[model samples]
Target: MKYIKGIFWLMAIACVIYAGYTLHSCRQRLANNPMGLELGFQKEINQTPVVLQSIERIGQWEFLSIDDEVMVDTTESHLLSPDDHLVRIYHGTLRLGIDFSLCDRGWATASGDTVSLRLPPIQLLDRNFIDEARTRSFYEYGTWNVQAKEDMYNRARTRMIQRAMTPQNIKQAEDNARHQVEALFRSLGYRVVRITVGRSS
Candidate 1:
């Protein structure tokens, strides 16, 4: 009878241990699961018709001379004019390449070999904006009260300034990226021959 009682207690303890483990696993899975919110909530927000400015790279070539029009196939435009405190978007990409040359020493007594060096590609990144909004005219001073028209004009002017600054932002960002890439090449023993700004595309 004592042995039987001992066996029952052991079984109870094993069952309790198993239950604890199961509960822990359930909690872990719940923690890993998503918060059960619907996806695509942010996508719906981005789909609103806001103006976007973008630049495209249309050409690239070897660094032969500075007069070469590297941006032979690109154009620019104003993307959007803001009416109120709305947001505008601009995007662009930079395209570039590298060139190299080799030198040979004739019959060197010590090394009996040749050496090679490379020139980094001339950067051919161009900036441009693509306006997608329908054109609108400024409000007349008499139509809207003079003070109201002045306020509207001032707001529009501010928006235009902000729109114009987009390209400058792209220029600075591309410059920084190019500098970093050049530094990386220098660390790898490649000489940066030149950096050129092609025509605006």
Candidate 2:
């Protein structure tokens, strides 16, 4: 009876140790996650407009004439150095019109309208550097030892999930992209700008 009791105590102690070890391993795995993954900006410039207007008064006859607005639309390609990221800008055409109204108080109202100034789809400026960095990091630290291979794998996977799929990481990437666009627009004289990001994969 005493022997059986001792055996029972031994088994309980072993189970407790195993459980503690597993919890400690899991905690350690959670600590090795890397943070921050962001790509550069991919910008597309659409159209630039130039307007010409003329007004003249001759022999008591008032005349106002305006030429069609000119638009320079061209694709501009930019490549980021060191990262070899590619960004293409597709330019669109601009449309210009005018509205004129006559008033009873010897006054007139004239307004110019400009339309069709838009941007093309901005694709990933570059992802080669990001891919290479991830690959190298994985190869360097994702190796395994025969004795602890399984533990290492579990830890690595946990770390990858924590690093790659964390809500904070997603938010950071989106914020970075939005800031890039905001800055681009600001440079082009957009004083009040709003940025919105959709869900990413």
Could you give candidate 2's per-residue lDDT for residues 161-187 as a string of tens digits?
A: 334445554455455555665576667
| Per-residue lDDT of 115 in model 2 | 16
In model 1, state the lDDT of residue 36.
40
Worst 10 residues of 2 by lDDT: 94-103
TM-score of each: 0.21, 0.24
Q: Write the per-residue lDDT of candidate 1 for residues 48-148, one digit (tens) a residue.
A: 67666887543333221111111111112334842332122322223333222211232111112222223333333333222223223422121234454
Each model's lDDT comes to: 0.40, 0.38
> How does candidate 2 score on lDDT?
0.38
Clashing pairs in 2: none
Total backbone clashes of model 2?
0
In model 2, which regions exceed 4 Å deviation? 1-162
